[model samples]
Target: MGCAISGLAAKAEFGERNTGDDAAAPAAAAYLREDQIQMIKESWKVIRDDIAKVGIIMFVRLFETHPECKDVFFLFRDVEDLERLRSSRELRAHGLRVMSFIEKSVARLDQLERLDALALELGKSHYHYNAPPKYYSVRT
Candidate 1:
């Protein structure tokens, strides 16, 4: 499948990790350039308040694009009408929770070590929920 989103993670070789090659990896310190960080910060300021809406849109797109992903979300698995989900209270609540995490991630960007730990914990949480990284990524 063609890439749809820049910078967002994508499954590598059908979700199977490729062998690590240090030469292909960017230096950790240069991962996010100062100008990139500034751009992200400025963009965050514009949408921070609308994160709930953004979250809802994000998940809605996820479900629509990859119907199989619904199996990972018990509450949404049986949902038949994607349009109706737009007004679902449960969905709104979940959206808030997801967006809140994004907010925290943005806030901790400068603290890479802390952010890394936070991400590790999040992956563990996903493991407990039986949601694999493949389900979190977009596919076509």
Candidate 2:
């Protein structure tokens, strides 16, 4: 899915124009309410936690199901191995970085400008893995 900001901007820029009172409102107007912002922040906390938990669980399960991936983990052979590849110090730093991003994103979920960038980076990092796309579909 697209980031919230980029998705909104793209829609405002290229989508068909509204033809009524809605047309007079700014494209971002829908996102400016304090309540909406709060909601987004709350939602983001849930989203961030859910995604992180799901990611970790999935990684562990993948390795359990296919022990060959253990070597990949030690070698940073793919995105799934990032957690294992870093040194203790590097892992600490990376953890902090990830937490900071998640906190910031949760604080300002309505302004989701970096999500797409994050997704792209993840996709690139995972590209070297030869597993079929369907491999991700098999749940533990």
Q: Look at candidate 2 and give me any clashing residue pairs.
A: none
Which residue ranges in model 2 land beyond 4 Å of their true spot?
2-72, 75-87, 128-140
Computed on alpha carbons, the lDDT of every model, listed in order, comes to 0.67, 0.48
lDDT of 1 by residue, 21-133 (tens): 53343213225556665777788888787888888898899899988977888888899899888888888899889888877877776777776677668778877887766
TM-score of each: 0.73, 0.32
Model number with the top TM-score: 1
Worst 10 residues of 1 by lDDT: 1-10
TM-score (C-alpha, index-matched) for candidate 1: 0.73
Candidate 2 lDDT by residue in tens digits, 46-83: 75655545445544555557766555444333535444
